[model samples]
Target: MIDRYVRPEMSRIWTEEATFARWVAIESLVARVQAEHGIIPAEAAETIAATPGPDISDVREAERTRDHEVLSFLAAWTKAMPDESARWVHHGLTSYDLVDTGLGLAMRDAVDLVLDAARELYRVLARRALEHWDTICVGRTHGIHAEPIRFGHKLATLAFAVDRSLTRLSAVRESVAVGTISGAVGTYATTTPAVEAEVLAGLGLTAEPAPTQVVCRDRHAELVAALAVLGASVEQLALEMRLLQRTEVAEVEEPRTSAYQGSSAMPHKRNPTTSERLCGLARLLRANVGAALEDVALWHERDLAHSSVERVVLPDSCNLAYYQVTAATELVDGLVVNTDRMAENLGATRGRIFSAQAYLQMTRNGVEREHAYRTVQQASLRSLQQGTQFADELGKDGIAFDESALDPKVFLQDEDVVRTRLHERLREHGTVTRP
Candidate 1:
């Protein structure tokens, strides 16, 4: 994640301190649940609840020597409690019972950050889209001029895409919010389903109906995939901004601070560094999603194979995505839209862009479809090569149709279609509401 986009809260969430805290929360909840099941004395549960978390110093040192985080945390936490009651702390559960459940908590917290970032982005996009509702720019297809489209329409389209991204994030949260306290191998060999229920309830999560060793890797895989998708959304916006910042387009640009340098040698260069970095990070997210997909195919009911990959992919994917969305919000919010440049570029190709509309109009009149297409194409080609106005060129291409039938003024005009359509859409999306 780029420094500019990395939120402090998101960074802290993925830190070792936060990870261990979640482990402690899960441990405390499990103890409380066990008490309800009568598996442990009420006083024992209370002591476990009041117990301080793992010694930060020892846990950090243990991570180095033990090469196992969850075990090290449990060791420190248990040591902090009196021996008699501490025995019931992790009773019946394997390391994953706490690890996977804790992972759920961490993921849920991380997702909340991402959702906030997305909503922020949506607000920026909606505002910017409406702000530029009437700002016109030449739309492109296959990197060539197509026709004029309001800049706000482009923003609103992105706003709609942002909504989809937010919806996906919400769904992924629900799917990944489940925790399990089921014993090793998921047989509940030492713990009862009631205990699992109580623990998850206490933790503000639902008990997984069933789990094998770890909360099924499939759930984690889904979350990783969703994060990757959200990253792609950021990339999509960034990619467009990159295109807009092109020297040829110069229709829009990402914000560049006075302290920021685009190039050391080229002093005049105001590069789209944020957008470029976003594109690069988006690729990493995509690769991580692939790694997550591979995690779905673990060796049997469980294997440590997925463990090592999850450690790297989960934190990195979430952090990177959070950074991407946050950066994207800033980028969109401060984007400089050059309406004059948009207008200038829109007619860069003269009247050729309206050729298709011209052809359609001529066809609607008495002209045959093939004949009309040829007529418009010839004039469009001449207008391009000879630097002639498309309407004039078409007028010079005298044909068997009424002179009035070939009038380009009616067909060439952009009119209010783009603006009207966008206004209806913006109202439908409820983006006009005051922020």
Candidate 2:
């Protein structure tokens, strides 16, 4: 992960020093397991275990001559051990045996961080949604007023999306948390399956059912795809915030700092910069998914093609995902919702937003669906163009419907019922405070 996208906790997991630490841990475990099976001398295994892990600087220097990272890492590890036991450092194992297994460990830790951030965001959204459960707002379709809905209902939808992303991250973590030690061609020709199982078990991972030098790229692709979907969910919420923060809409605003500036030239601007940043980062995640998918196919028996790509996409995607979830949580937590503005915007359409309700009422009264739709549509159009109330237009057109039943209050009552149902659904996932 680069410094630009790195958060402290996630950065620690992907650092060069940390990467070498995982590699050494895997090598030590493999040596211990080999000793248990009598493949290596017990004294050698003890020496390897007692040896301090090699420094990354030593490994890099060794790589200059070895030209193979795993061999270089082994050379560094052997250099740290007693001369008699050094040869047992990476006995009977291929380069990927350590590299892929260590990668699994790193990926598992990274995904766990992302999952925690996602869950926090989910809870924040749920609480905020409940806070605005009864706050009325006009729902829009095609960027035009369509009907009435509670502001909390829109927020509840975002909360559920975050919940789904959390679920995916959990599942992907399991998929990518597997390790493999099946020799060069994964045939166990030089090393036994029991050694692989024992070493992986010691490392808190399960052996890949079948591997060919490296763990299958499909598992990696699944992980990246999950992150991509998670990113999309984050982008969805940010996009909604961007729309709500528009000057004409003004239904919501990102929390402003006294020193915050939206632009250098404009004095009164308070833009949704965080939300826009999240939106832009989401595109990178989606694009990485394509590269991950492309990595799924390699030149038979595994090749280095996927290695170089995973080196970039895996850490970068996880780091960006962690940052996005945390930032979005902050955005939602401190969001300033303008209920007055929501109410004002709801009335901006002069009751034309109630056309759907009116249409439904006409159908309930035995009017044909098409006829009722046309009647309400025409009334709504006239109300908007002429700047008149839809109810008054309906009366002037001599449509025989109950004027009292067309009240906005009636629409609000129905919205309350819908909001209540949505709140109940949210409660199934987390606590929802009732008003």
Error of 2 at 253 (Å): 0.6
Local distance difference test scores for all models: 0.80, 0.86
lDDT of 1 at 69: 72
Where model 2 places Cα greater than 4 Å from the true spot, the runs are 400-409, 412-435
Task: Tell me the tens digit of each residue's lDDT in model 1 across 1-435.
Answer: 445546788878777788788888887887787787777888888999898887688877777877887777777788878888888888778888888888888888889999988888877887787687667788888988887677887887777787788888899998888888888788899888888877787777877776777777778888888888888878888999999999988999888787987788998898999899899888988999888888888666688888779888898888899888888888998899888898788679876777777788788877899999998899888989999978788778763334453333443256446445545555655655532
Candidate 1, lDDT over the whole model: 0.80
Q: Report, for all candidates in order, the number of backbone clashes.
A: 0, 0
Lowest summed lDDT window (length 10), candidate 1: 399-408
Can you write out model 2's per-residue Cα lDDT over 258-371, one digit (the tens) per residue?
889888999888899999999999999999999999999989898888888988999899889999899999999999999999889878988777777778888998889999
lDDT of 1 at 7: 71
**Of the candidates shown, which would achieve the greatest TM-score relative to the real structure?**
2
